[model samples]
Target: MRLLVSFLLAGLITDGEAQNWHGPHPWRANAVVDGRARDYNNEYFLHAFSYRHLIDRPSPIEEGIRGTAGSLTSDRLYMDFRYQQSFAFDDPDQAFTLDIQRAEDFDGSYDRQLVGFRQTLAQRWQLSLQGDVFSDKSLTDIYFGARRLHSEGSWLQLSLVLPNAYFNDKTDSQSELIDEPRTLFAQWHQQHTPWASTTLSVNHTPDATLDDRTQGDRVSSRQTRVALRYREQKGNWQLQTDLNGEHTRRQHQLDERPAPQAFRRDMASLTLAVRYWPHRWQPQVGARYFWLDEDGWFGREPNGNGEVSRQEPMLFGGMSLSLSDTQRLAPTVYLSRPRVEQTVNSPRWRDRDDHGFVGKLSVPWHITVSKQNGAVLSIVPSMRLHRFAFGGGNVQLHWPL
Candidate 1:
């Protein structure tokens, strides 16, 4: 229902003694178009741009830029564009994408200036791709893979993505060692009940060299999750409970080492919340129990270290009140064990048993700026105070679209 163009530019100008004019110049822009075309027809478009400049004295600082644009047509035609600067060579950025498909048109456009296609026949499967070209090295990464949706509600999805590559000037000396990294991933999702869900995913990144010493090796990460939620709603009182468990594993090489390091972590949490909503005010109280276990080498320690575990309990309470139709106020309080942890061999391990309290409050005012443009803006001011934290402050901002 709204088409908005947003732009942001930020840069840091430093004045050091020797490098008097040095810092990073960063800028970003985003454009979003959303509206309904006709009955039951929706269209949307999004564009984003980001640029960063690194400045040095004797030599000019490197400049890098990235841009992306995507749109969903009224007739289900989806298109995307992506480009990134190559700081090593003064070359224009590249762009690519997968072409739109119709029921009968499979061999569509392969225009060199605007689009191209590639087909690969692997031992087990076939892959088809098409995309536009901006420069020689940069191309849009696209792929499609699907799996069966079984009768028991289990579904699987497999996909391969070949993203664009940008030359890193810092590691240009070792460019030969760094290869372009590609990602392969598979995910499975299942719904066992109305209040329960499970997901399993695995992601693999092939060896991509950034430098000779850091010849990136194939890394694989896997995650499995199960969550259960229960809610009871009666009149003005509500009760809810959510429980979840997750396990993750990551394996990767470091510093051209042949042996790969593996890390595994497990986490489980349970939260119980109760709320009462009246005509003008709503109050909620919640408590959570969390447990975490981590094992294996984190690449810092040469010899593999044993596992570590932590348990924490947290309590939270919040309330919201509506002063009028266009104004609201909310405040929340949280108490949790300190996040600092001590290793078994550390000398000050006893200092990890502390607790802290955090309090936050927010108020929002909705104002109608224009009637013809249907413009409405909400301004919110928030503040956070932590008893034992390092920084505390208040924030005020108008919500941007």
Candidate 2:
């Protein structure tokens, strides 16, 4: 019965995200808390710069651009980890896990080594850390926080972030400039009950560095900046808002180097999302509205109000099906806001506002194997189709023990 129990209890985890499919067990996921530690190694490069000291993200131009949720997204392979072992799994009070990863890109441009760790502290506190070392440089990330076993779901965490030293040196005067950025952040969240909850986060970067991810450029080289977020959830609905307030001189670097164009900007955003999932056959309906306010460039850009105020409401709906106790299929439809777009690179004329429509079908599968006690394999395959847009899809695979 121990082997059968282990096989049934071992839940599948992918990209560090886990869901408990079965009840509690002696050697199970509940032994450790939080999903970050479960998948820290894979998100090293594509991670956020918070108090946790996560890995420095790739250059803006190198990062993956996300579209509709659950649509075909980037297949960028994060560090591949081979799990080694766990300590004191039966006792939920004291549990720990370790993983080793190879640091490199999908094309195998660079090579490095990474190690991840997660440990429970004094029963309620959770600690997670990740480190990486290349041939010439090394980076470290550490996080300390605690959540409750109560229904309130109250929690607090603080993280310190340090960027890569290789990118810190600003030497290239002609092109390709760089700087090392550091940040400190704190977050507090409280769930009064299943019906209501609130989360707030504040992060400060001593040296302002506005990373222009779309163009992969450092628009703002140096300045003091602060970013924060506030979110409140009630029932199946939630409202999230965030702000980026910084006093800095941003520039548009063109071929002519004598004097680059510069501007000062500020921005804020509010988004409301609501979801309904009462029945399996009834299409789950979701909707989101975004209000963007900006000044610096002139319209509706993040750094400017270029005189254009852009507000686009989106429509999201999907049907979820339960194929089995451990398997499910979900298909969704989306309607994006209509907007007029101009050619940026070539600088052309003739424009029209166009709305977007997309559809997605995703299947998630789980398998159990009693290898060395228990192991779970997870696979997710998805397909998407778009009207007057590029169609795409992706597949994800993971085996967790």
Candidate 3:
């Protein structure tokens, strides 16, 4: 489960060139209708690149991976690039990521490297910094962050994560694991008019970290979250709603327990969505509910009977077809049912409800109607069907690189 990989990074260059400027539309509505660059998204394409390939067999996790990424934006330099490599017939692993934002912000066989930045302070506070160096320094990582923006759709952010988590740990196999993560993000939105809208959010991470090298213990974890969202449109119908809550704390250490086990996790979720465009066709429906309440020690006040608990119910539907203006087609379906209720000395609890249903299809094509230098190319094909007889498909080609 920890076979990580990465290809090239760090002001990279060595027979693997050309990687950024933007627009690789594999979806997201075909990159908002063919990377709609509102006229040179402010001096566009200084650099942008991509190349990707992936194959996954969803019946016992067969795997393959390849990735490459590039990006560059200026006015103050910004690049968000990444690389990934992974494989399996047994074991293989890799990782990579590089980012520099406010300027704005890949690939297999790649080893590892990450660099990040985002700075802006007089015109509405902002600060960001990232790091992840490799060549095996235990695959280090330490990120930085800050943010602020107010006026109408307010904003605030915070990020700090130290990753290198999990690569070895089956109670000791040259134990290695890392997780010192932090996050605090905020948002606010309002539009009591034009249609209807309101959103409020908060995501908090209580400095979590756990480095237990089989007893060289250093455990700590705490998570947080809060959310509220609402949206509406009228005249074709479109609406969305969400409410979320999460809190988790985990501290564990065992080599025959010498006092070092504290666990607590709780989650709550709710979502509702509805859509109905109708011209180019679009029909959607959604419903979601999730809850997990259990875990002992550390102020044990969850009363959902602990050891661990879970309850999930979900259903979603979708359809979209806009076979023109850059071609499009989408289909989606989802269903989930989860129930654990509680577990302490459990044995899969006899499959815990094991509910299922999944189906997806997407076809996006934008064979440029004409445009050379500002690069544009897209082709997306994806398929998924899983229930009893699982299925899978993939085809992606995003130009540049």
The best candidate by TM-score is: 2
Model 1: CA > 4 A from native: 1-221, 225-234, 238-245, 252-260, 299-309, 338-340, 344-401
What would the per-residue lDDT of candidate 3 be over residues 101-182, giving only the tens digit for each residue? 1112111111234465555667687666656565554445555656576654345555555444323422234544354344
- What candidate 3 gets wrong by more than 4 Å, as runs, is 1-185, 188-193, 196-200, 208-221, 226-230, 236-238, 243-247, 252-257, 264-270, 275-286, 293-306, 314-338, 344-401
In order, the Cα lDDT scores of the candidates are 0.35, 0.33, 0.39
Tens digits of per-residue lDDT, candidate 1, 1-401, equal 01011011001110011110111100000000000111111101010000001111111111221111112222343221112222211322222322321110011111222133323233233233433334544333334444445434455656555543333432233333235545565656554433233444554544443222333333444444445444444456655555656565656565556687676768776767776755355677777666666655433222233445556666666666666655545554545553424233322222232234434333333343443432334343334344333222222112211
How well does each candidate superpose onto the true structure, as a TM-score?
Answer: 0.42, 0.49, 0.29
Candidate 2 lDDT over 1-401, as tens digits, reads 53232222111101111111010001101101110111111112112100010011110101111111122125433332222334555666545543333222111212223344556776566665544434434233222323333333456666555534343243222223233355455656555444343455555544434333334334443333333333333343333333333333345542323444454433332233333434454344544443333223221122221321334455545554677655555555545543423212211212223344434333434333334532333344444444343333323233333
Model 3's TM-score against the true structure: 0.29
Ranking of all candidate structures by their TM-score, best first: 2, 1, 3
Q: Which TM-score value belongs to model 1?
A: 0.42
Clashes of each: 4, 14, 28
